[model samples]
Target: MSRENTLLSASNGGPKQSPVRSNSSDGEKSARQRSQTPKVEFETERVELKKSIKFSGALAILLGNLGGASIFIAPTTILSLTGSPGLAVLMWCVGGLVTLSIAVSVCELALLLPRAGGPYIYTLQVFGNIPGFIILWGFVIFIGFPSWALAAYTGALYMLSLVYPDCPPPESAVKLLAAWLLVGLVALNCTYTSYVTKLQGFFTMAKASAMLIIIISALTTVTSDHTQENLKHFMDNSNTDFGRLCLSVFAGYFSYGGWQIITVLMEEVQNPVKDVPRALVSAMLIAIFLFVLTNMAFYMVLTPNEALQSDAIAMTFGRRLHASLPYLLAILVTLCCIGSVNVVVMGQPRILYAAACLGHMPRLFAMLHYKFLTPWPATFTMFLGALYMLLSGTVALLINYISLYVCIMLLVLLLALLHLRYSHPDREQPFKVPIPVLIVQVILTFALISVSVYEKPHELGFCLLILASAIPVYIVFIYWSNKPRAFVHLVDSFTDFIRKLFLLELPTTYINNHR
Candidate 1:
């Protein structure tokens, strides 16, 4: 096919080909047509995602993911690693600013290609099949959903804390709760996009309120308490170890990680050109303010050793302020984790759907529900992946693996941004980031990955092993055209069954004018 025709096919839905008719008797033809009627009906029905998300919804999606349990939990890790209250807070500010730069640069790409897949789509368009497939496989399949699994697990643990206040919850109970949360949220997402979007706004507000409560509580105790002593010598006993500092900064970076997901839902936003940039910048600023103040509150309310020793930093901070406050904070933190899972289920499937539409993944993933116009198949795919990770009991290792994997993904994406700029200078880009900002982002990413490896060299091997696993899957399922007939037919039958079961149909792709 010509480039124009290929683009046309994708925009229409998928690759379009002429149907072949056989020279069979009328009775035989009728029998075959009757047997294939459902498949024909499934292919004929098409739809698009509703453009219902405005600035508030867009900000909610970004904040919902950005202000996850990480903020409440990671401060202790950052403080412990840096061993200095001031240095730890500085790391948070630095991570926020660096991440802001990356977000704006991604805004440029989002504007250039206003699509659903975000980086996956950009990498596919800028690079080629193998690179794109690697991103979809390694990032979404390996890193994305597994991170959600970790969130669900954390949420479950916090939730169970309310029930078992004196001790911990059973491992089996935590797993069961996490699984139920995943199942319930996926159902919500598959039912209505607006339902999940509205939930994001509500949960984000709850998270912000929890932080504000902590900040205000700290301020009220200022005159009576000696918490200020912790920050008196801000840089005292600061760790100078390069590896540990890198780990600390990366922890801070993880708290600011979810802003990039905003670009993935450009197609669903009401006004992508204006609202996307507005929401991205505004959400980052708000998140940074909340995180910095909340950390200051932690150090102000509790001693450094107290803050470092506590397993749940926010819960401990609440308990120090009031006997009953820890219970309230636990509920809020659990909601934050649930909100993270909500946004993950909301956005990540779109990446899979986009890849499937491009023939990089199974076509079933490209299908949308007839009634809801949502990507049920892809969402279910994420649920299954997360379920596997949850049951395997390797979530902690996956979390570590994901941190490194995310840095590598971001570095490659930044390089892809540079490649697009010089290689396609003539292409229209409305929101251009400064050259220095891009340089800083690249340098910071490289430093993090390098130091992380220096600290734990074996992690690099595990990360590589996970990433390299994608290559063989791609070569077998996607790269090779001559798949076995029976195997292909079995896959097709399975896909057809899923489509019928969920009442799913292909969705039309929106190709922006610039691309």
Candidate 2:
């Protein structure tokens, strides 16, 4: 038999079909067996991801992703929308609370399902293949890639600004740098999956340290004279721009965006049942505390106008403390963005791999590298999508596009939790969120989408276009059950070629077993 068939058969739990010729000497056959034994054993043993991420690593990932450069950059947008330091601060608080509630609800789903793909898996398990496809579809095109692009874009912009303090950097330069950052990080993820936890730990520490310095510096500068002055006009510019305000809240929540990412990696997390919840809650609380303080510090140090007009809020705030602080702040914020991109690189491809394992995607994506055990095909595919977005789209446009669908999907995932509770009451739920919290989340999420879409029909129309585009693709590739033999041959040949080229193989844990 052929090599592909032999590996496939072994992975499928069938007896190994050794290609031993009858005319071959016994000595040659024995040598072949010796060479093959270790490989077959390796493939069979490492079917699932290794549980390498401990509690600290999990916390680092959640915090690193949540406390990305958004805290440094998003304050400007929020302050602009609210037009008041106090209300802007309030918006951050509200966003954090809402996100925390969403994370709690997701915790139940993560524990119950306890697999890769995070929200994608939760939706797939409860809602079946088509709805699952929609979630995965939105994630790949809308949520996942755009997030990486935005971080890279933000990072590149800040880095360039540091280099050219006198003039704005050219757009081409920014895009080029962003592309390089994305490529390098993707390569790191593909090459060294085991090192991700270490990277996350270091990045999270740098982020926390940077935020702390800013917060302490600002607080020390605050005194009785300016304290009352800052507080007196806290609500001075607050007004009702209902639509833009919703977008501001969206921005605030965007800062807290990646809290759910660890769920996708639960399979790789050690002590997932206990550690997942701990890491999520702890990271969120710390993020909220620091984010709110950081914004407060910005307002206290600079006037509302100064805070709004400045391109880099953290840099501006840092410069007040010392002339050289902006340079340091720029470097730290750039690292924060890189860390966020790293989290995305490490987590998002697992969604594609999980989908492929379930037959929702091409089988090639499901294959793991023979030696590294990383999902190289899915990782590289995601890298290409993110690179395209980085080169093509701007920061503001990507934010609007990503936030709407993410809210919609969060709403769906919460609804799925409720559905699972009702439908599978007898199911073993290691964690249970209060129904009221879920209900409130549903209401708030729906209201956010409704108001934003209502006020901005143009953005809503564009988002709907991207969303509806998935259905036709689904019908053609996934929904259709029949295909000509030639098409089947073509697909199989392509899958085989890529598998052999990359030294990839299917995992022993197939989709049928998952269901």
Candidate 3:
């Protein structure tokens, strides 16, 4: 039946109609509706739960999830660390493919578990509640949401440069401006999630096109003596420190981190089972091409030193046309980042709403905005948190924290994949990352382990928190689940007992009436 028909049929009886549910004869419902049951029955198809994601849409989600800040920052890190252009470039290629393999594994998991929490959902399912909740909040506050807000702030500052190059907004003003950006993007998400999603897809094309144009211009450089030396540096692999190059290329590899964002949106995505794998592989391929070409262009025109120095490198790239080109680059960056900013603005709140759905947060967040059909409470709270990030100029710290958060969440997901591989041996999948991919995933797990050990010692506490939430969940399940505490249950049980007693009376007393 059509969704409209079903809703209408379900609603025809008036206010209580939605809850009337199926007849006991329907059989499908008999398992759900006994008064003492623990599970709740949703009347709607919730087919959104089953729908697969599309290719373009998946790519859009992936980019919206990861595209912004990394592209701009990685090149600087690449040259600073590797110094060998060949080694640096090679790592990016290898990293992209390895990342793609990871993406493939995530897609497999998404198909198996298409829950709203994405990685959080997968984690909770495999690892249990505590780890899931910890990972959940970690992304919501510290990393996934805030980075996008900071990127928007970066855009706004770049935009303001158009008018006042001599005096870009002061530090205080930047904070205030970032706050406003955070609020504005939140407002955009408030308008409607579906609209924001469409906007993200649209903006991805624009970001890609603008980047392509700029990179093309850079690659087609007019050589001066200054440019020649930088060109020679890239081609001359002999003097490049190979060890440093391996470590140095991390910048570019890290830049590619967001491609796995598909894992986050697996639930809302239409036909995710079919679309996710395709979208992930495609986004990685496109991002790989873009990364190489953009870097080539960045190096072709400017030397390594110039790239490291410029906060707004595109401005310098534009200067090739005229001194006024920085203004245009500023405008482009501002607009594109706004698009990316909106993506995060829209993405993170779903995690919160998922929290509510799973009984962590208050249920109000689970309510769809009556008009917008988005999670109004969750989106609003996310905006407020982003505002906090903006005011504190804590973007730097937030980035550090969030990077750790993402790493932990990823580890959870990798483990989740392994769980599914063993747990559901009978299930057939349309797509599987080849066995070699599993080996790569094991290595990625080690990378995450190394990062955690070598870098963030504090993350273990968060994972411990994950373990912590489980205790309360267990307690709640034991204490309250089967026997709900409320006058409603009292009235309900009393009503059932009274009705049964009256039914016995009917058989005896109605004997006279029947005669």
Candidate 4:
């Protein structure tokens, strides 16, 4: 068997679903039905994706989340949060370590499952469909789309900042333009999904390289002129408590959120069980180092006050250094941003495809372009969703609601890990989350609580409310479509209670090696 087929056979828990013919009474899924989602009958060509590409270490971490905006803005904001160059880098180091803990946890779950939909797939198989669906849609519309919009908007504004640093533009127009750009991004996603990894690789390399240059330049040229000598004295729980700072860093951290978008397409990855961890860890390290180094560089060049007030922090350094460099940095930043945008454009549609495969959505989404071997319809739909978000003006507040979904997905993934630990004890998976891993998960959960507890109350409330809204959507669209009132009628609402309480586990199949 070919490697691709072997990977598919192993990755897919069962045979692909196909349209059933009434005459053929064979007890099996049909190939035709398995080929496409039943909902949309758009023409598709199956094109196989390349799986040989490999990314190592921090690049993998960077691959998951670091996008256009982080390089442009995160360093300055982090520094401003500290109000001191020395302390800002320190916080980045600390935050990177903390974020890695979560990455490690995600890696643990991802390797074991090695499927698409990342946290959503893990959760659905473990907890059940309800929780999984919530996380899945939460990511699809809320977290994933909004983040892309925010990134795109940030990229555009960053681009604008290059030409007109003095223009005090209102936030409203920025969002509408972002929304239009989101439509463009969605259209870009219609191109192809498989090749996007390479694009991201290039983006990752370019962004890191340019930032590194800036860092080196800053370090070489930085004198005590800009460094606040007594700024460290003010680093305390005064401006915002330690807890709030940590949680709000979620805003900062969102910049690095897309690295795992790769895992959402685990089925397409070559040797995912092995590669995924390597990618996650490597990406995290690179992002961590770059984040720390970049912050230090920014401090060397711009004071915390300067960094915070200016959106074009990198550009600030470039403008002071040379005439062409700011635009040059913007060029690289735009490419990096575009690359990240392409990466998301590649990822979310597959999650939608996964949902379709699970029968939670129309099956046409599962269809692959015969020519491209990619899920075109699913990809396009996600592109549209992202466009809508881009059109929305609440980029800053909007993304947090998205993060809440991302967090919920993480929560569900933990439950998935908990479930798989028991349900398929002897599965052929090579990786396992050890007992100590669980201990770390508990600690991470506590940390999330600490962050969420003392974090901005208003943002927290909004996220919760949005999450709550998914319950009805799930019932109306997914549940009603699958089986209306099936749960409530079956067990006098006990079934409903179990589903809500335990989450509905809807694995791809119970069969083994059936693909």
lDDT of 3 at 127: 81
Candidate 3 per-residue lDDT, tens place, 1-515, comes to 22332343244331232254545466556543353132112222221222234567667867655557456534566656665555456666766666666667777887887766666777778887767766665666666556666776787777677767766567776667677777777877766566667667776776677677777676556466655676677756433554454343334335676664566666667777767777777778888888767776777776666777877667666765557656666666676777777767766677776666676654445545323445666777777776666776666655544444555566677777877877887778776666666766777656655645454466556545644565565465422546546854774566345433322111111122224
Error of 3 at 183 (Å): 2.5
lDDT of each: 0.81, 0.82, 0.62, 0.61
Q: Whole-model lDDT, candidate 1?
A: 0.81
Clashing pairs in 1: none
* Model 2: per-residue Cα lDDT at residue 222: 69
lDDT of 1 at 185: 91
Task: Name the top TM-score candidate.
Answer: 2
* Candidate 4 residue lDDT tens string, 1-515: 22333234333343443435688856454555445433122211112333534554224324535644566655555554555566566666766665666667677777776666677787787778887777776676666766677667776665665566567456666666565666665655555544455556676676777777788777666455444443343343334457546654554445456666766767766777677777777777777788777766666566556667765678777876778877778777766666666667666677877776676765455545433456666766666666665665555557546555555566556656766767777776655657676666656655664576465567667767777788998887667745647653664355334423422221222111124
Q: Which ten residues in a row have the lowest lDDT in candidate 2?
A: 1-10
Off by over 4 Å in 1: 1-46, 510-515
Models 1 onward score TM values of 0.89, 0.90, 0.77, 0.76
**Using TM-score as the measure, what is the rank order of every candidate, best first?**
2, 1, 3, 4
Which of the predicted structures, 1 or 4, would earn the higher TM-score when compared with the native? 1
* All models, RMSD in angstroms: 6.1, 3.8, 10.1, 9.3
